[model samples]
Target: MTTTPAATPPGWYPAPDGSGTSWWWDGGQWVQPPQVPAAANPTTLARLALATQILLVAGGAVAATTIAVEGYGVGVASDYLNGNDTSIALFDLYDQGTLVGSIAAIVATIATAVLWAVWQFHAAKHVAGQTRRTPGWHAGSWFIPIVCWWFPYQNISDLWRAIGRVRPTWQIAWWVLWLAGSAVSQLSSRVYLAAEDLEQLRISMWLSIVGELLTLAAVPLACLIVRGITQGIVQRAATPAHTLVA
Candidate 1:
């Protein structure tokens, strides 16, 4: 003899439309569906955002310290070139510190970038319905060509506005500092690497100093941006989908 399928039993099940509504099944037939509030847990995204900003601030400090160490090397080299007494041991120590600091800063920066991208990816997902930009764009935009500069900002600005319908003015200063600092830092590093004499080395060191300062200035702005966006997302997550701002 053939057996029949068991009944699903009387219960509420999510609607097939994915609109966050629930339909009741009364043993044998479906009942009218009602709207149910959709829930979102974005604590992980908030934590990731906070971690990324911490790394960013720490990376800035590391970069600034590295620049300072290199500046000291310039002074030591200048003294030795000018016939003043400068110990070779001291110069060697400065060189070692600069090298180590540079490596640490590079590593920290890479880690921070990765964490930041991950955070943005998840954050964008929370507002997927409200945005034209895809979640992938949130992270991938940073690695794109010329668009990297503009797209990342646009994606983030969209996220900010989509959540609370408020314009993020702080992003302006944050983006400017990030772009300028990156350009200046790259240029200064190239100049420093190409220096062939004490005068050239000193000038390059000064440029590096300026670049590091710009980067340092951007750190706080970055922290603020991350915190604001993350907080907005977390707050939105606690609200019912039906009550959310469009």
Candidate 2:
């Protein structure tokens, strides 16, 4: 006599061939075996992150160029105020240069910010789907003006935490480099503001230049970090449930 296996639990699939292969139950009847989920690929995610980084770096460089141009303008204005005719001509040259540079810089900054925001939003969406946690407020903090400059640091920290939750092996070196670069930039600005004379101004300019350079360096590092995080997420997603340790 032939016998049938007992009914499977609610919302569960029946094993194929009575061999106990788990299948999804459609609440009415048994269906085909569930398809294996796709695994995340680190290389692809890294490439995307790198693309975002490139955009960010390009934007930052443009902005910095404009800032340097503006600095030259300040020097020229100083000379003009001092009533030196030759200095006035030089200052005029700088004013024109700064105006052009400022326009370019603003354009680049907006473009880069938009790209970065898009990439971050995409990443957050993927993460939220995987973890079932809403990324609402955390993602919105980047657009809040004065608070954005520093508060975004906290947002980044939280992002890193979420990344770690998904993939414990993810590295965070890029975040550190970005933070260090920001500190240097802030210090340079403060030093420039404290300068009293032309000689001091010159010195302060050099410091500012160094700070800009550091920021430029950090841009790439930050990109790498983003790439790493993306890769980690992809890798985790790709990992098989059986292979993953609880």
Candidate 3:
């Protein structure tokens, strides 16, 4: 005797390998129909997104404070050029805080990605008729080189349009700031690490300051976007799984 998988409503979902075929979900398993990957609870995704942003913001603040304590603007580099021991201590503290923050951010990001990918696939299934993009592309685009940047945005756009909104304002703002902060922050860190003189170090410090400010501005927007999307999904989930099926 075999345990029958508990039944779910019938729908068309992505092929398990994400290879672009529509499989039928037989109100149970992926027999003749396709199946969406398992997703985390909506509340869980929202909470994780919020927590990750908080950790990143706090880490960024700690980093900025360390720079401020050393002083900002011109000639500060020469001021510390004598190699004060206190400066070294400050760096040690900053390093520790940064390490913890980085770890948290990384873990949270992976979870968020997986959660969104699954949700997108499920949402696509509810669309009447054929979806513009394949369900596999919903999650797979993020991992593809170069195309990841724009493809993820495309996938997101398709997901929300299915829900009757044309992508919220908060999402656009969040993505822009996120990409900007990442670029400037990476550049600043590289400059700081490669500084060969007091002047170079000073420039790098200012860049770091700029990077922090960008990320700081981005945090709340990110939270709002996450909340909006997660809530939207939860509300949609309340209806029959394929209410919009053609």
What's each prediction's TM-score? 0.77, 0.55, 0.57
Residue 100: error of model 3 in Å? 5.3
Question: Clashes in each model (backbone N, CA, C under 3 Å)?
Answer: 0, 7, 5
The digit string of per-residue lDDT tens for model 2 on 1-246 reads 112244544454435457565544444444543354332234544566777777877766764785576478567657656776577567557657756764775687577666666666556655665333345544565677666656556555555566674322323444455556656656756775787865565565555556566566667656665776676567665443332111
lDDT value for model 1:
0.76
Ranking by TM-score: 1, 3, 2
Candidate 3, which segments miss by more than 4 Å at Cα? 1-78, 81-131, 239-246
Cα lDDT of model 1 by residue, 52-119, tens digit: 88898888889778777877877787787778765445777886887798789789988988898899
lDDT of each: 0.76, 0.58, 0.59
* Stretch of 10 with least lDDT, candidate 3: 237-246
**What TM-score does candidate 2 get on C-alpha atoms?**
0.55
Question: Which ranges of candidate 2 are over 4 A from the true structure?
Answer: 1-48, 67-85, 129-133, 145-151, 165-214, 242-246
- Name every residue pair that clashes in candidate 1: none
Model 1 TM: 0.77
- Give the lDDT of residue 229 in candidate 3: 55
The most accurate candidate by lDDT is: 1
Over 1-246, each residue of candidate 3 has an lDDT whose tens digit, in order, gives 222345646665665546677555556655432244456234554555455556545554654553454243333344456765345435555456546655654565565556656555554544534446887777678778888778877667766676556687667776787677768768977987898876686777667667656766776675555455556666664433442211
Worst 10 residues of 1 by lDDT: 237-246
Task: List the lowest-lDDT window of 10 residues for candidate 2.
Answer: 237-246
